[model samples]
Target: MSPLLDTLSNAVGAAHVLTHDDPGADLSAWEQDWRQRARGRALAVVRPGSTAEVAAVVRACAAAGVSIVPQGGNTGLVVGSVPDGSGTQVVLSLTRMNKVRAIDAANLTITVDAGCVLQAVQDAAEQAGFLFPLSLAAEGSCTIGGNLATNAGGTQVLRYGNARELCLGLEVVTAQGEVWHGLSGLRKDNTGYDLRDLFVGSEGTLGVITAATMKLYPLPAAQLTAWAAVPSLDAAVQLLGLAHQHLGAGLTGFEVMGQFALSLVAKHFPQQRVPLWDEHPYCVLLENSDNESEEHARAQFERLLETAFENGVVSDAVVAENLQQAHALWHIRESIPLAQAEEGLNIKHDISIPVSKIPAFCAETDALLQHEVPGVRLVNFGHLGDGNLHYNVQAPEGGDAKAFLRTMEERVNTLVFDAVARYDGSISAEHGVGSLKVDKLPGYKDPVALGLMRAVKQALDPHNTLNPGRVLSA
Candidate 1:
């Protein structure tokens, strides 16, 4: 047996380590990203069952001068969790540490092992009569550790905030084989440096997050979802302002989609009929939740819609009558990416700007794209309330998707990112700066900020053995 393999086996047991030639060592999910754009070769895949085991495994790799890639769930979009093409890296899988240590209802927090799936955590919270609000479409497969590592933001981020905000404390295995047991579930810790926040979005470059304490909220009594067709993006922005004035915190979610994007969904999913038959150029999906009663929630939404229609900001509307209908409405919003994928491969962008600037940004960007990349199709929608958009582009119909990406992808990205910088926006909003965006970071990110990131990386993982070439390339 190889010395490194023997050491890993001794640390966590032989059954948990899988060499490339071992059974089920295809490394399909662990080595490749969700988009299948980034693939790598790994020496072996090791599963450690506890923080101690993880620390030991990390130590062994450090001593052997072998690099390590810490991975969980493997559902990340930016290829952040996957290793590079190099075959010398060892992947430390956290699936075996799937355990829920404690759920303190009185304190409104649940401390769980990093490998526990997001859906399981949410279910646990619901069963305990609370709500774990950090939700995503991949909740069934994505792990809390991966979510925190990426600082993921989903539909609920508009209200409950991102993974970083929901996380209270973390248990991490640092690069030098030391465990930082900062798992105190205190709401306020004023003692020192915010190491917890630093590691939350380090993308495993700093350390391996073993477990976390997550905040929970009281379950809402009712939720109302609506599909509204707007006259224009500007009109949608006006409606958003009205919602804030009228609904306040009760406005849980606000999403916007262009005509082309909505058409793609309806075309691919025949059963998900569009809300209204109209030549509307824009559509808005809004959700309002009430902690009191269904009647109260419905009344508020109806009043808001009434005002919107009276102002002629909304051209048409449909309110979901029940939970099943609400889910169906959301299904249309969630199915855009799937429909686009079925259509063909496209270049994807996750961007964020000020809520007030979103309308102007969209208008200017749409015109810019049309002029520069004529006939290219745009599939766009996003959390309008939080200023994040999944703005993607596909080759013109009857054109080659692959060839278009090859020739125009980088140029298109430059165009979009340059505009984003002009508008004071972020290049990566929800999806992180994984291997996909590593090269793009230096140009967009401030030089001093990049230097500080390097300093933090050096201090935490001095050997640069963990997730090499990820957020900040070595």
Candidate 2:
């Protein structure tokens, strides 16, 4: 063990090699997950400044028969990026490799180190007169490597697509410490096999993503936002249809929030001034990105809202008058999860159903959950345009939240996941199957599909050298 640590220290300067043995060295940031769901112990935390250093670390760990957990911002909710409690795995941190390698304006692509923050990429594109539409609430701290690893679908998935669709190429290090330089920003390439797709959403089980070349879009001329009060989830779905018909490709975002969810935001963060939540069962946030002009975008939004109101789909609505107002509206939408945390500990589900079946799914699941666990408060909200919902559950009012979770977490998950299967939906939509959902996947996921996944995992990481016990069991 000492020799291996010495080898790692030599490969990437000793200063970058942090260990639990060091006095006053705290590894909680890299050991714990974003949700605080599980904290693991790591033998060493290695921060490599370059791809070559990462490769060297991998080679040394492989020779020493040690598992490596590749980590980025440590903002993953599923506990995928952190190490286990064995205290033997190496935590490979990529934050030191932060750099925007190149921006090919002509090709509409930007190549960046895996450690680049998502917001930094977006800002770079904006500065270069382009748009990077992959956005999430955690963009401020989440790295592009983690985003692509989970195939993150954010607010703009309705128009731009998920992280998998936005990426053009990747630079990965195999389990054998070989680098695959696949960062060719070509839109069309008839390659033999699409290795890029294989690793994009692999969750680091297959390889380590060091850098990526992602697609970019032209900046919209005007982006207008609207907040609408809907009578029900069904009406919210109807409003979504109207938005697509009116805005078409310009419909960049359509988020749905339950009244209870909004109330939590208002109750926890009073300064947000959540609108249209008191009188309605749900409120929807819409975004229209137009290339023509703000006037045109406003007109389209107005027409959409007018038709929705006429069709009895909307009770009330308000369109942002300026950029500041638009950002304020978006801020409220992104603050739901944080507000939920502030309220108390809760169970979260990031499930996705077909657009047409979401209403029925929610109605049935809501009834089923209430019947199973009386007085359980539901915090339902997510990207309705893309059919993904963050259908979370809170404990009964004034009860012990921790005790409720300890006793009911398993039951609640089973009830919700069973309903998701009935609706032909996935148990996980945006978040990957980390250790939290790894065991549950076997029961819900198809046997044949699961077998294929295990086969791939064995082929790529036979030694289980990369992210052992994640996505697939070690």
Candidate 3:
């Protein structure tokens, strides 16, 4: 252990290798997840400044027979990036390798280090007169590496696609400390196996993502946002179909929020002024990005809403007059998770059902949950355009929230995940199968699919040297 630590210290400066042995050294930021759901004890937190340094650290850990957990931003909801309590695993932190390697405007691609923040990448692209559209609430702190590792889907995924689709290439450090310099801006390459796709969503189990070349799009001439009051979940689904029909490729974002979910925001964050949530069972946030003028975008949104009203899918609606208003509306939608936290401890499930079957699935699942746990509250909201729902469960009013979570989390997860399986939906939509949901995969995932995944893991990292006990058991 001492020799390995010495080697790591030599590879990436002694200051980069953090350990409890260093006086006044605090590793809490690297140890605990943002949600506070997990806190790990790492043997050491190794910050590598370059891909070469990452490979060196991986080699050192592999030679010592010590497992490594690759982390970026430390903003992940699942306990995938943190080390276990054993205090024997090395945490390979990528935040130090933050850099924008290249931006080929003609090629419409932006290559960046895995440690580069998502927001920074967006800003870089914007500065160069382009748009990098992978966005979520955690963009401020989340890293591109982590985003690709999880194959994250955000608000713009309806038109732009997930991180995997946006990514054209990846620079990964294999488990054996070898560098795969596959980064490129090429859009078409039928040369062989798609290794980039394999590592994009592998969640650090297969290899360490050092950097990536992500797709970019031209900045829209006009971007308009609207919030509509929906009578029910079915109405929301109808409105979504209408949006696709009317807005066509112009539609970039379509988010659905249940009335209860908005109510939580109203109760916890009174300043944001939630709209039309009191009278409707659901409300949707829609975005239209047009290549034409702002007036054209506004007109398209108006036509969509008018049709929605005539069809009785939307009872009321409000379109943002400016960028500030648009951001405010988005802020309210993003505040759901925080508001839930302010209210109390809750069980969160990231699941996806076919767009057409969402309403029915929610109806059945809601009833089953209410019957099973009387008075349990459901917080439902997510990117409806992509069919992903952050269908979270909250404890009943005026009860021990912590106690509810302690005793009922497993039961609730089973109930929700079982329903997801019945609907032919995935239990994990954008959130990868971290240590939290690793065990749940067997029952929900197809036997053949699970076997194939296991085979891939064995083939990629046979000794489980990278992120062991993550997507699969060791």
lDDT of residue 446 for candidate 1: 95
* Candidate 3, lDDT over the whole model: 0.94
lDDT of 2: 0.94
- Give the Cα error of residue 344 in candidate 3, in Å: 1.1
- TM-scores, one per candidate: 0.98, 0.99, 0.99
Backbone clashes in model 3: 0
Q: Rank the candidates by lDDT, best first.
A: 2, 3, 1
Provide the lowest-lDDT 10-residue window in model 1.
20-29
Model 1 Cα lDDT, one tens digit per residue, 105-202: 89999999999999999999999999999877788999999999999998888789999999999999999989999888999989999999999989
List the RMSD of every prediction in angstroms: 1.2, 0.8, 0.8
**Segments in model 2 whose C-alpha atoms lie over 4 Å from true places:** none
Off by over 4 Å in 3: none
The local lDDT score (0 to 100) that residue 182 gets in candidate 3 is 93
Give stretches of model 1 more than 4 Å off: none
The 0-to-1 C-alpha lDDT of every candidate, in the order given, reads 0.90, 0.94, 0.94
State the lDDT of candidate 3 residue by residue for 1-474, as single tens digits: 499999999999998999988899889999998778999999999999999999999999998899999999988888899999999999999999999999998999999999999999999999999999999999999999999999999899999999999999999999999999999889999999999999988999999999999999999999999999988888998999999999999999999999899999999999999999998899999999999899999989989999999999999999999999999999999999999999988998999999989999999999999999999999999999999999999999999999999999999999999899899999999988989999998898889988998999999898889999998876
Winner on TM-score between 1 and 3 is: 3
lDDT comparison, 1 vs 3, better candidate = 3
